[model samples]
Target chain A: MVESRRRSGRLASVPTSRNVKVSAGLVALFVVVVAAVAILVGGGDDGSDAPSERASSTTTTATSETSADAATLPPVVTDDPRLLGAPGSSGVTFTEFLDFECEGCRAAYPAVEELRKAYAGRVTFNIRYFPLPGHQNSRPAAIAVEAASQQGKLEEMYRRMFETQAEWGEKRESQAGTFRGFAEDLGLDMKRYDAAVADPATLRRVESDFAAGSALGVQGTPTFFVNERRIDPRSVDDLRNEIDAAIAGS
Target chain B: MTAAPAGTSSDAGVRRLGLVLLLAGILGLAASAELAIEKFRLLEDPLYVPPCTLGGAVDCGSVMTSDQASAFGFPNPFLGLAGFAGVLVAGLAVASGARPGRWFWLVVQAGMAFAVVFVHWLIFQGLYRVGALCPFCIAVWVATIPAFWYVTLHNLQDVAARPSRLGAVARIARENHGIVLTVWLLLVAALLVERFWAPWDSVFA
Candidate 1:
């Protein structure tokens, strides 16, 4: 009777052991699933939000500006090969990665030009073509600008590109006449400039610019870098403060 | 042999379902929190792309900037936050011994269904049209799927716990849930094919 009772007790405990093991297995599975989901949701392997990092860094930088002395003058624009200056000698650089055919890029021109006049030689601005292939007319517009660049009338063509963007051909064939018209307006040697557009070197340069912009995380046109730092021109005093800081730092 | 009564086992299952639904609600709430941060980032940098930057395979900026991301004239994240909040509140209420009415459970069922359909539209836009992925948005999407699945399963089980319409709904749900999840998985597979395996020639065309 004693042996039989012992055997029965062991048999009963088997179910309890099995139940414990199964529950433990389930808990482990749940933990694994939750951890996997956490890792996936955190985005980068570094597990931090990249966008907010950029924004917070900018915000902190902006807030720090109030401490600087107002009496100290900022730097004046230097005629460096890398720097493209506005009329006012502003020492800040406005580096724009732009697509000629983007409506937003076109819309931003007046604001950009206004900044140029407002800050003048205090700000140096450079434009890089970022022709997104999705927009049919953008690549041709970029090529046209390259041809104009060959003729040493790049700025004139850049301005006209934005001015007549709405009117210009979004197609390859129609862009040829538009290119000729721009060359005539800029008083360039039309034949040579047209040949430059077809040159492999010119096309390669535009492609290189696009690649560089992509590497810099320029997702869309009208991305601006002020004094080698990214800044949104839309914020009140954002461009001004950054330009001032860049001037002081220089 | 002391077998627990049938009613007791059924109650245990109901309790378990309640726990899972509550957990899913928490996940949804977490997703919405991240989404709110993304919306603020968008304000700071209109050109800001969400970090879907795994490769040319997934570019977040493309999708986030599209019209679909702001379907209601505001960012979709805001809507997600509100919706998830309601779910969290309802789940909490259910857990705290507040017995929801039939209409309340029905509303929950409809909301889950709506979420499943909306996520399908978003996945399509990301894959075929927008041609990019937002990492956080994808997180929300992933969380939403399981939340919907668990909620639907729980609702049917709850119906089964009751006598009225229990047999009919359980049979219908059991038959359809497999078909629904299978279709969802296939659609996602098709999107992945279009994005990764499709030739450049066919894709751009």
Candidate 2:
């Protein structure tokens, strides 16, 4: 057995001239595998026009053309609630399209609040509702906050939602009761709160913010825009730098 | 008699295997070290953005902050650091003509098997649960898979010499090592593409 093993090992040790063939085969296999995967994964798509519309809209919003038309520019800050600073301020404007139930938004809440405080007078901070369809509680949570906004408690409800996100986030069922509890905690008038929560106009207002965000190429939660330009920040420092740059430029 | 020639050839094969291990060990070590440093920095400052974070789906900041990053109550990269250093030393010894016994090979095989499994688990978490990709973690994965494959193949060569169904299977796999490795890597790539199809499509669109 040992003798035969030795012989086979010797045979295996002899380098073959099949290197090129092996390389070619590997490349071919890669192409075949990639193509197969693409077909299998992409098969479910019904060739919806949603992606194309988003693509064109993103392109239009991204480009700063010669004409300064209102339609050409993205609505960086519509009638969305302002958390800090004010409209028509000479300082830089920082806008965030966020879902209250999003983990990312919850994670970012503290840093954003800190920045709002740090650059209170210099940078304008605006919040736009962008309730993602995936989160079961997102729309309801947005509505709850919108309801709080009606009672002059938007900031309190907003902070409460993020602070207690872990308790109600990622649940399959509705968290309306939990949000209502938040409203109650804030000592809001339950009757008015319930009416506002149940109001179709409030929901439509939230949807309108989402529509504006979608038109501006906001694909994910906590998407930030500084001075009407989209900023993909990897860190709190990155966000701070962008704000600083914007302030400097302004 | 014929043992001298066979020994020389086997030694050469061991040398090649050692070289592979040495290179892979270096790569794994570097990636692990980088991740460890980044992990430490992140712990020090929650708001500190990792250098590898590219935002969106490719944010290392999100991955590092995840619970899985410290699976065993410590950073995963610490395991990488110690394991890769061992591999490096073993490879250096083997490449310099150390003919270790079967026990040595088996131990290395077990370590690599654990590494491969851990890496795949991390990949799954990164894709579905975490919903983000860490570039440094991906580098570690790339280093680990091929190292595990080659080590397994090397061990299978001995198993293939035996006459049994298992031996027969090992023989086929050993003979077609290139094909098997390529397929393994491609499958992982396919998974990545499939999982992040939305972001990928947006990029192209």
Measured by DockQ, the strongest candidate is 2
Once superposed on the true structure, which residue ranges of model 2 sit more than 4 Å away at CA?
A1-9, A13-24, A32-75, A78-93, A120-124, A226-250, B1-9, B37-75, B130-135, B154-158, B194-205
Predicted candidate 2 versus true structure: per-residue lDDT over B66-170, tens digit per residue: 668888988899999999998888878887888888889999999999999999999998887766677889888988887787777677775677788887787
C-alpha positional error of residue B135 in candidate 1 after TM-score superposition, expressed in Å? 3.0
**Model 2, residue A84: what's the lDDT?**
39
lDDT digits (tens) for residues A72-157 of candidate 2: 75578665554633443555788888888776677678888898888876777888988877567989999999999888888899
lDDT of 2: 0.73
lDDT of 1 by residue, A104-149 (tens): 5665677667666776766667777777755666777788888887
Model 1 ranges with Cα > 4 A deviation = A1-86, A90-93, A101-118, A141-246, B1-9, B47-60, B154-205
Question: lDDT of each prediction vs. the true structure?
Answer: 0.58, 0.73
lDDT of 1 at B205: 27
User: Model 1, residue B13: what's the lDDT?
Assistant: 32
Model 1 chain A is weakest, by summed lDDT over 10 consecutive residues, at A54-63
| Candidate maximizing TM-score | 2
The fnat scores of all predictions, in order, read 0.00, 0.10
Worst 10 residues of 1 chain B by lDDT: B1-10
- TM-score of chain A in every predicted structure: 0.62, 0.74
Score chain B of each candidate by TM-score: 0.71, 0.90
